[model samples]
Target: MVPPAVESPNPQLTQQFLSSALSQRGPSALPYSEDTKWLIRHHLLSLTTSFPSLEPKTATFTHNDGRSVNLLQSDGTVPMPYQGVTYNIPVVIWLMESYPRHPPCVYVNPTRDMVIKRPHSHVNPSGLVSLPYLHNWIYPSSNLVDLVRALSLTFAADPPLFSQRRAPRTPPSHNPNPNPSPNFDSFSSGSSNPGAFSSGYSRPSIPPNNYPPSPYASGSGRVQPSPTTTTSHHGEDQSEVFKRNAINKLVEIVHGDVVGLRKTREGEMEGLFSVQGVLKQREDQLNKGLKGMRDEMEGLEQQLQMVLMNSDVIEGWLRDNQGKKFRSLENVEDAFECVDVLSKQMLDCTASDLAIEDTLYALDKAVQVGSVPFDQYLRSVRALSREQFFHRAMVAKVRAAQLQAQVANMASRNQHYAV
Candidate 1:
């Protein structure tokens, strides 16, 4: 069927609608991030600008997982060239939550009179479209306009839908009444039912010129019957017609309410999911902090144990020296003996190094005051420096031995604690 021609949408209104739908805070707001929303707006505008036949709008999308989300949708027809003739093929493009990162979902939105062509590689019976471009979609590069163009080309090669043939109606029997009034059947047949159309709008299989121009042809691209063409049934009971109309109105109201409720619930779910993500991040941070605190506590405990052990050793040495009394400075020096032979050697080397440093300082002072000659001063300094170097080397070796001994002692302490 030849799709209805769509008029160019008002730029200001289009922008306004997109802004409202993609607002950060609102019931109608999309789930896209701020940057993504801007990209979506730009992509939609670009598409409509390039192909005026396509119109952007918002709709509810239901996933296979039974989750409902409000998403931006482009519902309209794209121009496809088939066998030297251009035809408009209706389509719907759904921008998912992770759009641009992920490709948009395209579908062949066929009208009620049309049926999907089976065994098609690009299109499935459920109207879901699969194309090479979608498979290799790259972010910030692939866009809605290019996707629509690809769809047009692919559809041109093999159309996704074909018109469903209907059997011809038999001619009505002749009535005896000279003034024949329209019955219920005649009234209903002529009346336009909105439900008769699907996939947004309907298109005639024959040339558009053969039928009357659609009331919405120059407007929103939707097909609506003209008011003038709507005729009242004179023969049918007015009360019965009113009852039927009232029931239909009630049903529509109920349907609208249900849709609104679903959308509200879906919005709540999205909010909850966002809160959950925040909570998960905080939980991870807390866990990391707790582990760090535990490590710090263990280090402090180890330091306290080492300090206590040194205190115990000092107390034992004090007790051991409690009975000893020194009569002279030499005896005091002998009383405070080194803990081991290596410790005594380290102490002797340290003292000799300090003595040499003092001797060098005295020689400098004597030379400055002319008490010592320059040559003598130089010779004395050289001799003192050589002796000091040997003492420092011995001190370094002793310190290395002490460090290794301390490391061994700590390892033993750790092993004891483990036992």
Candidate 2:
């Protein structure tokens, strides 16, 4: 007899196993971030605590893109409650590299004696499971425990597997006849050879009584025999039996083809979803770049406006003084006359300060070249700096007075407008 696939929960063992798998380095390392690995370990531990049947292990998972990754897998059975009794349904859950953010891949791992029920709402012919919980998986909130619970609940409503029925064995007759008449039973059973049953499809080692009652069984809790087993050449025409067998074979072929096509389509769809996620990330980046460009364009437009205003002021000044000719330096100074006494004082102070600065620079250069003695250069610099200080102080005072005057003028204009 095969050992039960599920075992009791062992949190300490589970943790140790996960730690060992996750800590592997280099080529054998799990392809998960440090934080993700931690989360995976925690999630598995918690899941095992809740459901002792599911055990964590590592497996190589190949994606639709043909890339193989060593991912953490949880394989065992989940206890599903049906008709007042609980049944263990074998399943394998693969945690993808992008788990938490994306849902894990789940498949119904039926045993040799079990066959996946066709037209199953949640499980596909290829054993892939689709659940609303997986579809609505939310990161940070969804966990392995909850997912397993959902699977159990969904499967309890509609079980995914049914026990495969084997060909019935014929009972030996004790009647001592010299020769046995040929019949449909003898031909169907191939009774000439005692090992014919073993040569044919191998049946489950477990007795029929040990098998769970199939969910597809009728009200009497007995599975209805197939048409081939119930109908015989003795009761039905031989031509009809051959035709039925041919039709069944054709149906099986078509079902297999359909299942293959469906699996291919599902793989293509998964690839498309991955591409869509990549496209969504790129779209977010493009949107951010476009926003930055828009902000930069606005700043540039503002600068351009300021430049245009400054250009207009310079152009107006050039137009106003284009024909005015200065006869001497004094006339040139007069042409750029200040508007007020404070403005005139600021202009004079600024010009005197600049002149003193030039004299100091010349003295420094003269000292550097040894044209002027260091003592004389120092004395001249001291005197010029004293004078420059007074000029700069005067410039500051005049500028402050001018600013105050402008404030008063603006206030008076506002008062007049109010009146």
Candidate 3:
């Protein structure tokens, strides 16, 4: 027994869906691995959100041939430019299973007419790889609609960040001899010569110095800087990028350390002043004690001499009158106590002198080390500031380019309808 007849799948319908998905909304979200869809979808969504004015509408056109063509599903139609001239914009977003880990192939339309600026071309637009500004295209957790919107907006807006060219520089003329001070706009490098720089900008060599200057003490010649190397506004020959980075780093480091030292210095001053005051008091006390001890010692010597003389006289009397010998013994004991008091005063003075010297030494050491800590900390902070500055500039450039493109597209479209 044979089985009943079954209907066959319509090839035209399949083609239409595939074409619509590719041209209108980009690749199917279902066919793609979850990771691929998420990554691509997020980038597209962010691009669209940036421009609220534009909306996408679908249309279909079938040719005289039996083959029915849908703008999105069939061979994609070139979008009509704002001037009503047809500009072919063919973009394809396809994914591999190893995406994010491996970048997807993103075909940008209108490649022949599309002139992207330098530097930005180095980036991968998919945002899966670590390209400089590619991450701007992506957002977190997106859908297919999001990706289509991003692509549409991205094409509509041609931001200068993505276009790095500076007025499409012309190469130097090959017919003329290379000379110093070549004009940036018009220069001759002989017809056969390639551009000096990759961007085709003319960088002239330094002219020979007609007037020789005297040598300095270091025996270095007074060489004038080449105009080609020097910045137009500044005599410095450093690249703008390097200069910016250095400046940023320095500012950051200096500001941080200055603030820290201000706080630290206040605390340190209080302790130092207190220690200084104690030291001064000890010095004054030692001086006063020494003076008093000297006076007492001299008086004791004089008194002893008087006593000795008296004793001699009294001895003669004692022989005659025994009363004076007992009085002499008491006088000798009083003189010994006075000497003991003078010895203790001398020991105290020496101890005070040692304490003051130790304190002074410690304070000097602290001052020496504390002087440079703030400066060192400042230098470190400056380094960080420089890094931050560069990152900010890079991000800003990409954003600016994106905005420029969007504006340009809008203007073109508005002009188209005006006609």
lDDT of each: 0.74, 0.73, 0.40
| Candidate 1 structure, TM-score to reference | 0.43
Worst 10 residues of 2 by lDDT: 225-234
Count of steric clashes across candidates, in order: 0, 0, 32
lDDT of 3 by residue, 1-419 (tens): 01121223344554444444533443422333433343433333322232222222223433447653332211121121212121223444434334333433344422321223323333244321122223443222322333443443343333211111123333458436454444433322322122422333421222322111211101232333222212112232458446545644665566568669988999999999999999999999999999999999999986685566557656865586554344556566453232243344444444454554565455556557795465654664465556545545554565456446545755786799998
Per-residue accuracy of model 1 over 327-346 as CA lDDT, tens digit each: 76665577677888889999
Question: Residue 232 CA error for candidate 1 (Å)?
Answer: 46
lDDT of 2 by residue, 10-86 (tens): 67777889899989999998888775576677778877866677889888999889999899999987766556545
Candidate 3, after superposition: displacement of residue 62 in Å? 82
Local error of candidate 3 at residue 115 (angstroms): 42
Name the candidate, 2 or 3, with the larger TM-score value: 2
